[model samples]
Target: MKTRQALFLVWAACTALANHGAWAQNNPVLLADVKAPRVLMVEEATGTVLLSRKPDEPFAPGSIAKMMTVETVLDALSRSEISLDTTYPVTEFAWRTGGAPSRTTTMFAALRSNITVRDLLSGVIVQNANDGCIVLAEGLAGSEPAFVTRMNERANTLGLSGSRFGNSTGLPPAESSMTAIDMVRLARHMRTAYPQVLPLYTQADFEWNRIRQRNKNPLLGTIAGVDGFAAGFAEGAGFSLMATAMRGDTRLYLAMSGLASEKERQDEAARLLEWGFNGFTSLTVYGAGNVVGQAVVYGGAAEKVALAPREDVRVYAPTGDLGRLSAQVVYRGPIRAPINRDQEVGRIRIMIGDAVLQEAPVYTSEAVGEGGLASRAKDAVWSLLFSWL
Candidate 1:
């Protein structure tokens, strides 16, 4: 088994290199020409940005802020703070602030109507219903302002430095802003950490109060493999989209803000996703549990310990390869003994040219016990001999 695994690893490495050579002959267009003022496309497995434009510049996110609403509610559900079946009273604040008379987009929840968390999620995510968000906010956190505070806390926890939430619906008060990159990160985290809610994003239409309205996501059903997320538009924010799609094993995320119109938003998002799928192919350099390399150990029974990735090590190769990709095994060296098997000790940094795309944590493959006197002396001798050489 060990021999076959070793042979497979060697063969995989060689095959990847040969494919790199073949790909170099074809020059693929860079995404600099993509016209969206702010856009980002990230390959999920490797955290590789196939394309990005002003990703960090904050702008009005419109309803894309609802993704955070979906995420936060799902988290509350998981913690048993709420349940799919739990119902909340539709407060006047929810109705008057975001409901029909306000002339804002809504799920049409009647004043003081009791609604389930599940139904509200569908309304907010699928319909981008502002009333649904306010209701959930008021129900879960007592008020929209308190819920907005939680959203910011969650955003900060997610490392979304360029994002702030002014309301559950991402309405503008000048304080709510998010960069394309931050939106992408938020979407990716939600998809990965809370996959159950993703299907709600794809629902074609939601019905409430006997009024059925179709989902506003332009890419839904139109774009192959496209799953739904959220879209937003405010008078000042223009149109924004945070959408994701999966084909085969690869999932790609896109976030764009300030699109001139709905048509432009759809066109730019589709073009970007198409470019991503066509512009990059991924390479699995190390499978989970496969020993990537070895690390020197001190005071251990073994002089060196096998290092394996905590998860699979995948790297994105541009559709038409520039050259063979490279990576480096990085860790604090000469790991001291009493190391347990499966202990995290280091990481594998996947690289494209001088840039690092992904870092997969590496771990010890077996326990390293404290060495006996004889073994210690032998290691000491080996170190001395290697130093002399």
Candidate 2:
């Protein structure tokens, strides 16, 4: 494998935007004021992270893990393994552990009573019902432990490397943890993959067994564009929140943990959400279909193949010019011949200083077939020379 540094230029227009008086200066000071030990805020459109601190450090997710639980169920629904109308019984275990007996957040469903998947989702989303999570876990996988296995598997499939589920309900005494970055990834995936089901998070309240509870997420309705996601707390991890907000064409996902109080959690989340929306502007790094870079094609008719992003490669940059911006096209090479058009070959990583702010996949723009014996021989000689160097 070899690494090549390709040319990456920032358009003058981006610099002009940064200079414009309308935009606020990049505020590292404000970000520093955030009290959470782990925090991340990302632009949904370009996946550009506006602010991050200890994003990869794992912490007890508390009720925030419910988002993953919801994602697992949504995955099952998409696979047709279960329907919204499917029902599960609330066993004594569920009632004792998460319902009225446990004195935690719950939908208060009667023991041995069966509830529909639709209602369970409502309970989980709107009420953060632990019993609903247990019932759904048991119903879907015949036991909570079995369902937990599915949850961890789903997390892996989703590329959430910093998360693990010990139980469906995220209750204490059951080990479950997640990173700030993983929470953002999960929230983004849920919103993107399950748009139809996202409205469940906006539901203000849910009623079951004649007991009603308002949505536990504090940001909803209070923040200008806050809509869905969850808030959580653990004894050692303190408070945590995973939330998404949309204002017009832009949407942002945020995750923060290790706050001192619930008030701090809500306040820090709101502050970051506002900052994410107002503190950055979009900059197109590469237009749609524009060749971003090139990758060596081994034994191909052509020595190299052009690579481009299928969509416009964009990043949300700070309004102020506080840091140097650069990009690199990264790929393992030389890619073998017979590469098809639009085949993914590499990634474009956009960075500020040494920190990667965003990354997007790049693909071959055209097919490259195997070359003649002479071409192969020439490439082999060049490869040998480079190896010696």
Candidate 3:
């Protein structure tokens, strides 16, 4: 499907297509031929590791290092420390240093030329301009080394334990390295907290001084629902991609680092995306105010109270997995009377593995009205109300 978002990803529906053998068996195993040891596919919302292969192991980040670059730039822009309209004077060094050495990312670059910060950002992101990356980095932090420090600092703040930054645009003589899990973590962070920055990854094309540059991501227009994210390749790093797709509330994010070939990476990523959706589901069995279960009452007018699957419990487990899912309700100590029907009497814990996926609130089923004088008197005398109700 063609999207107004610059046709960054597309799916080949060509006739006589291959029947993607994507379903990782129940005892899923990575292809024996797979060279990359790390791969991770996670559901962004819940952090469910759907499929993984040594995902925590660190590897070359390749141009994907630019992921951090884009993030730092977005942070500065969002904080108003800088503006897209702010212009930077392209010095001789900025021209000769960025991009693939001798090649500039944007057209506004010529000795002594001036380009706005917005233009430079577009170069770094939309055009994958090395020059733009250095300029934006220097513009914000006064030098690439300072900017690199800021990037690492941000990475630490985000809990990217396996990630580090050496340069703004990932290039040869790499000193930076990150794990696939860490890359997925970065993608998840961007997708959840900084979505406005997400569009930069899908920029199909960019223009500078009458020059046009197309995004290097081949999946943008070819894959359905593929929006923002990035792709990277280098002899040392092979090809890597961190991408997401939105199929309604069910959005899937996948990351593969250290692939042996471009085709393998895309094929594997697309396969994982398709499998995640086809084999899993999002079931919101409960909504706020929806009575889910009944809980026993104590010293109350009603014999029992209602419990709910509080906070809308949604799961991404395999189909039919919801049927086996279970919950445990909890609330503070001995129950009291006069409870509001909407009161959060307890919480529901949903579990699949050992982990408690989520906790939803459960409320009293009915208003536990105060007992009558006789009932109170009975409670005071025989203490049966607390036992009977």
- Winning candidate number (TM-score): 2
Model 3, range 1-389, lDDT digits (tens) per residue?
Answer: 11111111111111111222243434233356344567777776655667778877777777778889888888888798988888777666667776335653444465566678777766776777777877877778988889999999999988899988888877666488888878877887777777665677778888776778798676788777888677887666678887888777777777787777888887776777777777775555456556665654435676466665435555566653444455556665345566786777667666655656556566766687767766545445443333343
RMSD each, Å: 6.3, 4.6, 11.8
Residue runs of model 1 more than 4 Å from their true location after superposition? 1-16, 23-29, 235-237, 288-311, 330-346, 362-389
Backbone clash total for model 1 is 1
Cα lDDT of all candidates, in order?
Answer: 0.79, 0.85, 0.68
Residue range 1-389, candidate 1, lDDT tens digits: 01011111111122234545665343454556666778888888788877778999988887787888888898899899989999988888888877887687889899988999999988887777889999999899988889989988988988999988888987655368889998888888887789787778888898999999998788999888898687888676688888889999988988887778999888888777876777777887677888767887766888888888877777776756536466677776567677899998777776667777677788899999989988777666665655433
Stretches off by above 4 angstroms in model 2 are: 1-31, 291-310, 322-349, 360-389
Per-residue C-alpha lDDT of model 2 across residues 1-389, encoded as one tens digit per residue: 34232333322222323344554576543666878899988888887877789999999999999888899999999999999999999999999998999999999989999999999999999999999999999999999999999999999999999999999888899999999999998988888899999888888887888888788889989998889899999989999998899998899888899999998888888778877877777777667788867888888999889988888778887766434566678887788788999999888877767777778888999999999999988877777766653
Model 3 TM:
0.72
The estimated TM-scores of all candidates read: 0.79, 0.81, 0.72
Error of 3 at 150 (Å): 1.4
Error of 1 at 244 (Å): 0.6
